[model samples]
Every structure is written in C-alpha cells, then in structure tokens.
Target: MAKIPGVRPPDLSELTRAQDRMTFLYLERCVIHRESNAITATDERGTIHIPAASLGALLLGPGTNVSHAAMTLLAESGSTAVWVGERGVRYYAHGRSLARSSRLLQAQAELVTNRSSRLRVAREMYAMRFPGEDTSGLTMQQLRGREGARVRRTYREQAALHGVAWDKRRYDPDDFSSGDPINQALSAATTSMYGVVHAVVVALGCSPGLGFVHTGHVRSFVFDVADLYKAEYAIPCAFEIAAAGYADVAAETRRAMRDRFRDGRILERCSRDIHHLLLPADEPEADDLGPDVVRLWDGGSRTVAGGTSWDGEVDW
Candidate 1:
C-alpha cells in the first residue's frame, strides 16, 4: 500500500502461514508477546497465556507501549510496527524524520477548544427540567430537561429507609451518565473526543493521570485528554447511539463508546488533528506547563486555577 511520506511508521507483521507471526505489546499495567496462532503475555497476575490466532481485529495504541525486544522481533519477523506511546514514551531516532511540531499542535488544540467551549456553554444555558423535546434539537435546554434529577428524595431515603446514615447533600453532576440534561450534553460532548485523546495519550506514553483536567486518579489525565474532544466527537456519537436504541436516558458503556468511535460518520480529519497534537518536537518538561487544557480533581478546568497553566483560554 502507498504511504504518507511523513506518517509515523506503520506497525505490521507477516503471518507465516502456519509459519508463526509475532507481536509484542506493552502498557503501564502489563507486557505481552504474541505470535500468529499462539500468544503469551506478562501482567502483574503473572503472565497467563492465551490463544492469539482467533482474533478478527486488534485495536492497540498508546499509553500502552511495547518493548524494544518486541520491536526487534517485529523487525526480524517483518511485522508491522505501531508506535503509539505516552508523552514520555519515545524511542531514539531509527533515522525516521518526525510528525508535525508543537506550535502547530498547540494551534489546532486552541481551535478545538474554541469550538467546544461554545457548545458547552450553549448546552448549559438552556438546561430544561423535563424531557419534552425530541433528540434532534441538540440544544442545551433539551439536554438539561432530559438528564436532570433533583435526587433530593434519594438522599432523604438513605436516612429513612435502612438506618444507613449519609449526608443528604446534593452532589456535583459530573458523572458522564447522570440524569441532568446539561450533564448529559457535557457527557455527549466529551465522549466524541475520547478517540482522539486515547490516540494522543498512547503516543505520549505519559501517565493519563498526570492531567490538565481531572485528578491524579489511577486513570490519569486520560479523562482530561478524552474531554478535549467532546464538542465534535461525542455529540454525534450520542445521537447515533441513541438512534441505535441506546437512548439518552441511561449511562453508556465503554463498549458502546468503541462502537461509536468506529462509526464512519466521525470526522476523519480529527485523526490528523490528534496526530498533530502529539508532535514529538514540542516535548514539555516536567516543570514546563504548556498550552493543553488543565483538568483538576474538583471538576474544574483552567490552568490559572492551580492546574498546569496553559498559553491561552477559550472564553465561550
């Protein structure tokens, strides 16, 4: 197949017809080595082996990385190479040039931020208390009306129902699948962005928890990265999933997310935008705060709010 002269090297391999095709995968949680028709992987649970030949498709990428040994094996065995790594994940130059620069990536990120902020504010302004409208409006009022629940009674029930005492306090509506319409709109917006963020995080090989937004939770800045894409990637996916019978009423799962990510209606240029966001040239130092969004644990997003300060802000 033809190649993009500047595209990152394709991860590939030749399945030796009964001859043995092999691949190696690495991630923060585990390491794996596999070959066509057979497979072996190592995790903290102590390397439980599995049959590798049965899979119809393999979706592997960054945040998860592979070892040099695996790369060497693929090179010797002529397998495809997929170099998705964390921000910290980098291999020395094997003589290949590089992707785009950080300035361009920052620019693209800025553009997406401006685009998404407008959608987010719009969704919040029209927070409706009931689900009277249809799904196509894509308006804020529709989002809030369809998704909100006062939950005042649920909190009261906890104290009265089973002698189980708890604060009858109202919680922040941050859960992606909450009943709040504005919350639903925000969730829809964020879901669409996950694919691009996932790809970028994998390429960076940095901890997804070390985020601009979100806390230093085990998941890392992964949610933060994913949040960046909500305006474009998530809204359409939510509507489609809703249309396909996964209504906007309940929570959506990651499985449903992957399906939506695979859908053809997604804007393909976002892949290029994702790639641009991960340009190796503009590597941020541990102390050097850059232009990316900073998501803190308190559900607030802003570099000025004691998270990593960014170069610009999108005021929608």
Candidate 2:
C-alpha cells in the first residue's frame, strides 16, 4: 500500500469537529475501495474520490459494495459509514468511533442506570423541547402525554400551513409505497437527521442506546437527539416538500433536507445539544472520576480510584 503523494492523511482530531465539513453524503450503486491513500468509489456511472475525513456521514444505500480497506480508512478518518436503505430511509449499521476517551459514555451510563437520575435527565431533555415552559416535578408518563400533544399540534400546524391532507403517519416497512407522499417525506427527513446525530454521538464517545428521553431501540439516543430539531427542520421541510408535489418527491425532499441542514447548522446544533443533555450543572470534570469509579481497561488511560491516580492499570 504505497502512499498517494498528494493525499495527506487525515488528522483524527479534526474529525471530531463538526464545522467546515459536508454534513451528509448519499452514495449508492457503487463499489467503494481504498486506492493508495484515498477512498474511491466505482459504479456504472463512473468513479469518484470520497473525501472521507471531511464528511460527517456517508450513507451507503442499496446496490453498494464496500471493501474492508475502505471501512478501515473511514473509521480512522472519523467519518461514519452508515448502511442505509434507499434514499437513506432506514439505518442498519454504523462504523467505529474516532474517539480515544470513554468519559462521555461513562457519564451517560451513570445517569441512565440510576432511576432518579434517569428521570431527571429525561425531564431536562423534555424541558429543552419547550423552552421557558416549566416542567418541574413532572413524571415520565406526564412528560410523554405532554410531548404527544405537542407533536400532534405541530402536525396540525404544518398541515394547515401547507394545506396537505392531515392523516396519521402511515408507513409499512414491507411496502413503503403504501404510505402517502407526506409521510414518506417526513420519514426521509427525520432519518437524515438521525444519521447526523448518530455520527456526532459516536464521535463524542457516547452510547446511542443509553438514552433518557427515548428507550428500547438501538438508536434511541439518536432519536432523542434528533427530536430536538424536529420542529424546526423535519416537520417544516416535510410540509414544504409535500406541498410542492414534485415529480420526484423523495429526491426533492432529500435535497431540501440537506439545504435545511446547512441553513440551520443542524449538525453543529446536534453536537451542542448532546453535550448539554448528558453533561449537567454538576458534571464531573473531564479528569475526575470520583469514588466508586471502576476502571475497565488498561491503555494510555489515567484513572483515579482508592485515592490514587495510576497509569496503564485497570482497577476493578
């Protein structure tokens, strides 16, 4: 594997930052491989070089072939590789992290594993969804009721604004065509947002399954993060795209969603929101893991347990 002369290897640190990079790229019907120092994709159309380091997430849709070398390059570069269905409709898999520290993951697990702390985190997330509204002392069930009402209101508002027929969200996994055009648009838009949030979550060393607001699914944390921006981006974009009634509705929605992502700085907002949700007012400093801290692995890791800070050791 000779180094390509002009291709400078990506700096792992740069991959953590969400700014100044393309947020989303959808690639389908291609064969992706590592050529020298670059990732190149070939298809019946032609060949193109993928800027793996500068991309937030690469959506590998149907009819795509990916090599192990390509995955290795993408993982090292900090760009996520998401295996999605057509038009990024479904999320199936994700590449590895570019993170070295597990601090965020530990904090999230601590909060989620505690019943009281989990409820508090859930309340905090719901509070953000409705700024200036008091959500004090509300139970999780109460929060769910309020959230449902709010979302229903949002749907009605969007439908009224765009004059699209307001029906329940209908989608059959086996038959996507069964759903109406607007539902399809909504699905495409939200999944795109989820993809972006998932990439940022993993990059920051957080578990996508350890979520407070959303639970059960593997991507519950992703849904939790994406919901923060749903009203601002997904709902409105779906309405606008559906109202236009373009000949190619899916393509139109995808393009408009990408535009909205850029205009709204969605990826940057997602990064900030995840940090805010997981790190509270009394969050432990990055270097401090207090008493009861369990060191799980030994590496370049520094851990403080039993009144001592040791290097390259696991304290169980």
**In candidate 1, where is summed lDDT lowest over 10 consecutive residues?**
91-100
Candidate 2 clashes between residue pairs 3 or more apart in a chain or in different chains = none
Best by lDDT: 2
Show where candidate 1 strays beyond 4 Å. Answer: 1-196, 213-220, 239-259, 263-271, 278-316
Lowest summed-lDDT stretch of 10 residues in model 2?
285-294
Q: What is the C-alpha lDDT profile of model 2 across 140-226, one tens digit per residue? A: 889899999988999999999999998887787766667788988888888888888888787767899988888898988888878
Task: Give the top-scoring candidate (TM-score).
Answer: 2
Per-candidate total of colliding backbone pairs? 45, 0
